[model samples]
Target chain A: MSEFKQAEHKLLLIPGPIEFSDPVLLANATPGTAHTSPAFIPVFGESIKLLRKVLLSTEESGSQPILIAGSGTLGWDAVGVNLVERGDEVVVLNTGYFGDSFAECLEIYGAKVNQVKAEVGNIPTDDAIIQALASKPKIITITHVDTSTGVLSPAQHISSLVKKHSPETLIVLDAVCSVASEEIKFDEWGLDVIISATQKGLGVPPGLSVVLASKRAVEASENRKTPQQGYYISWKKWIPIMKNYEAGKPSYFATPPVQLIYALHTALESITAKPISERIDAHKAASKYVKDELTALGLDFVPKSRDIAANGMTAVRFPSGLKAPDVLPKLAERDIVVAAGLHKAIVTEYFRIGHMGVTAVDRQRGDLEKVINGIKEVLGKK
Target chain B: MSEFKQAEHKLLLIPGPIEFSDPVLLANATPGTAHTSPAFIPVFGESIKLLRKVLLSTEESGSQPILIAGSGTLGWDAVGVNLVERGDEVVVLNTGYFGDSFAECLEIYGAKVNQVKAEVGNIPTDDAIIQALASKPKIITITHVDTSTGVLSPAQHISSLVKKHSPETLIVLDAVCSVASEEIKFDEWGLDVIISATQKGLGVPPGLSVVLASKRAVEASENRKTPQQGYYISWKKWIPIMKNYEAGKPSYFATPPVQLIYALHTALESITAKPISERIDAHKAASKYVKDELTALGLDFVPKSRDIAANGMTAVRFPSGLKAPDVLPKLAERDIVVAAGLHKAIVTEYFRIGHMGVTAVDRQRGDLEKVINGIKEVLGKK
Candidate 1:
């Protein structure tokens, strides 16, 4: 129990399951405690309260937060199975691979999905969205930061557009990669839902699928005539449990991932103790530092414009004649790890580096420094 | 960093989130590593292979193990959404609370469910099962050990009966409470699916939903005409990923719970290092010891007979004029943690104690001794 120091290992710079803070990892090493214990109830409740703050939503905003035991992809299932009824028309604003997957998930739930797919590393334009909205879609899905291309969709602009053009349309933002690292105004933007995970910008290991539902979304779920097609991910069962926990009462639907929730509690505490603006600014600063160095190395990015690039990660094209194996191993030898491309069309053409959470906010670890130097050394750049 | 040693705390004697071994807890404290890393691939691959051994499955038996990031309930969702198609007739044998939940999950997926109920601590008898099977249900669901009542259903006998009478009926066993603590011959018993979680008998912190699918279940998933209503829990997306990982190739459909999987890897290694029979025997001996001590104090059990009781845990009725608060607090003062009642009809009538994993098997920790002593002190029954 020697103060819970993380063991020395190669720096993890992947998009998720990223390098975690000492306190966060240590929190996960807690002794086996019952989910229903008095000590754990408050931990879970406070975590729920902290989630509202993370999204800049107050009690008056009438938003509910969910903490379920699943990966971020399960968030898509929650949105699909709960929100989209059979044959409901949904507009999916596709930025990259994650967008494609989300569209497919909605279709699985019997939704008639209209995917407005963007070219690699780009998001759909507002005009295109306005056109899609003309069809009077029931819901519009946006990937805040698609991990595959490190492309950040204009969520704020899209949310505003949806509110003005189609006041009844529900706006769902997939913020799995952007929650703590980028700016999101749940109440101000009138977002119906924000789906995220404990990993990535939350500075915790991956497991819990964290979701926030606005008043409108919950109302829609309540008024839907059709029964929910799924059970574990259904909003109906989770709503009561979430409400009980937030009101300082312990309730159970399914056993929550006890240790992961504890870790999320510690991570959220670290993220919320400081102004969220500072965290987002820190991520931008770290992202700029890495991007600037990579640009100087004559590397090109997948994203066409810097404005569209995500603050938490950078996807850069590999040099001509060099595939992932050529450069990844060199970085691995230098005790650093990065991600290969995920966009199916250009998967071998690019690689991604993540600078979120502690790796971005707590620079004392010099993780970014090592990553910069490792890449420079690997690419024969001074 | 030093090796992980969990800080001393009260002994966790609940049914799940059991006391983990030092090695298992240490494995969870590992520094964050990418799920697709070369080092992680083999670890995950080996974990899959080890699951087969734990279930006593052979490679040629065509049983596939799925490791998903979720609670035990997700395992039920996996079975429901994938195996039980719309309007499919399914028979659910109700042993306790978990059976009710599983039946509800199947109904959520549009299955026509027939639940054969038993008394508080007993499982549905062979005659009742034979009557239910006469309807020629597509799947027969059995809870190996219903955690709420510590009732062990006769999985082997039920499996044999299903194979004998309804040869095509898929036998799905909810083994969340029994997997590592009891004997399950996955191949020999001809089970189609065995759903479990890491927190229970696997002796790891809760999160991963570990499922084993037989060839028939896989075929059922594949040959179904109606599209899968779920995406995250769908076998179609996960089957390729599981196959790829088992083949030692890292593939991603969703980000796996990296830390919990590592913990499971360590826990499984410890469980499989010794003969599985010894582990089951240890659980039985521990259960007898605790039950004997309680019986000497004139306490009754929810389970009507020792043969029907689960080896991993015991559900004992409270003495006259005593309730959970009266006895549990005193036990907590002695640093022993147990569980309150869960069966709805007799919600306040009993409490449960878990004697699985290292608490029951290792014995060196003297955890069971503390639990027995704590209870005796609480009841003034030395």
Candidate 2:
């Protein structure tokens, strides 16, 4: 790698802004390269191409990737403004905090939201989803892996249901926590939009809002009945910009985060170095190991079952009489940083551990072991 | 610093994404750090405090700084969605391309934008601005420095005019190309909002959108007649997040770009290390030197007069018979990168050279000399 090593830091076992590889960080430290420079255009273009391979979508499939400088939340804005016109009915398959927030975001743009909310540790029932579709909502949003509870929704199943019940309803999978760590067959699943960010399973630092839209999604956005409500997150403004960059030409609606794009290029390069299925398998192994170990330590989980849990991360409940302050600080003292619970219903009862990116794929890092052992030691002391 | 050296690359002399210091890039190479970790909270909090110093604003003045992950364009969204209600009258003091785009952004959020048009490479006249204010528009937006033509509008004068004629009108300064390189006395100038990004004069990479809002502006946003038109860019959603972080507590509406915040922390540390006035003077000196040398070489400028030209960048017209294609490629051959014109009316006649941050302040780098000499050689060859 060029003999460059990042400075020592805490082990970030949080769901996102996960442990990035040295090559990725080195790319992030790239010198000031113009966004439109020959050196950067290919990086931007290649990132777009690699995102398709990661999502299992393709250019021939008429899928477009819109990459912008913002968090995953901005993807919600993209959907609200571009896909949903004022007062259009939108179904939000709510699993956790993200689902609640996504529904709120859509409503902010004047969507009449129909929420299908699940219990604290469960996915929404298929019947509930079908009932929501009865209204023929213009869009249905599914949080593929909600970060708050580590719950994995049945995206493919949901997409199939949307197709069978309401073929016109766009299927938007909020894959912010799922993309690289989970197996997503975009075209095969008949998915319309998969909204994501770089910091999670993609293994780059945050600052990029990545949304992959199918042909139908693009058409829906373009043929919106009303003028776009927002300016920055408007797909109309970004479509040409993405098209131009993918064509190896430099164009600007707003300036791209050039350094982050470099980091993403390096990250996507490593991520797609081999078959993506292998990476997904690695995450599965890591997740199982962490969850199994935590279960043995007498901790419960936020997800109702193993099958419903995300492979990229796990949300675990503390033992009896234990809360966030009781466990999180102890782990921090051991140089491991994880996130506290975010679901308001069970906010104080659980915590999250992320096993994506290098943590899952690069076993030599010993990140999972350190976290597991740290938790075990903390529990023993308790 | 820390024995970390960035890889050698081409000299980027464009208006922004300017050459950053080694320290800033090294901070960008930081390993995974959670956005809410103890280590990052202070870095974020300190960056917020330092932003006030750079802008000559005060917490006591009740001004709030909202930092989010996006380009400078996102700052426009923040203004449009938060402050302007549907049918609200807004005045745009048009200077160049950025002014036109900001007007477009405001209009997207339902503002009736009355743009006081200026000729190419010129600022709007006082009489035109006064006439526009006769409607007592809700907001008056000024582009402090239009990157497209290197034209710097008289922000203070416009603020004075607005204050005298329409005291209730909010003064918004689009200082994307001017923030760190130009002196902005937010409190003294009666500015309601100063929209900027990190790349240009802050000496950080592009990703973070930084906007400082006056108390009145925040009130106007909170007391909006209608619901906010956006979700992600909504000031209502971000104000508490900023306040919580500034108060040394972690709160999240959206995930912040962690590594970029680290880079910004380091960049701001350096920018505020000395009196901000010195940094502004350095940019002015560099701009003058480049302008003097270009004038000596018989080159004309895009801005009508030297007084109204931007201190962070120079837009120079090619000598007659020589266009961007004739001179820019030759400079590129010497590994010096400059930007082609962005203002559509004069897009083919001129190109821009940036001399901000390290290029302007760190004389030992000889970056400006390299670019000036490269241009001179290209002209000599022609």
Note the Cα lDDT for every prediction shown: 0.90, 0.92
True contacts kept of each: 0.89, 0.91
Candidate 1 chain B: worst 10 consecutive residues by lDDT? B1-10
lDDT (tens digit, per residue) of candidate 1 on A1-382 = 3577788888999888799887888888888998888878999999999999989987787899999999999999998878889989999999999989999999988889999989997888888999999988999999999999999998889988998889899999999999999899899999999999988999888899999999999999888878888889988999999988888888988889888898999998988999999999999999999999999899999988899999999999998889999999999998899999999999999999999999999899899999999988888786
Show the colliding residue pairs in model 2: none
lDDT of 1 by residue, B322-365 (tens): 99999988888888889999999998999999998999898888
Give candidate 2 regions above 4 Å deviation.
none
Give the best candidate by lDDT: 2
- How many pairs in model 2 have backbone atoms within 3 A of each other, for residues 3 or more apart or on separate chains, i.e. clashes? 0
lDDT of 2 by residue, B252-285 (tens): 9999998899999999988888999999999999
True contacts kept of 2: 0.91
| Every model's TM-score | 0.99, 0.99
Q: Give the number of the best model, judged by DockQ.
A: 2
Per model, state how many residue pairs clash. 0, 0
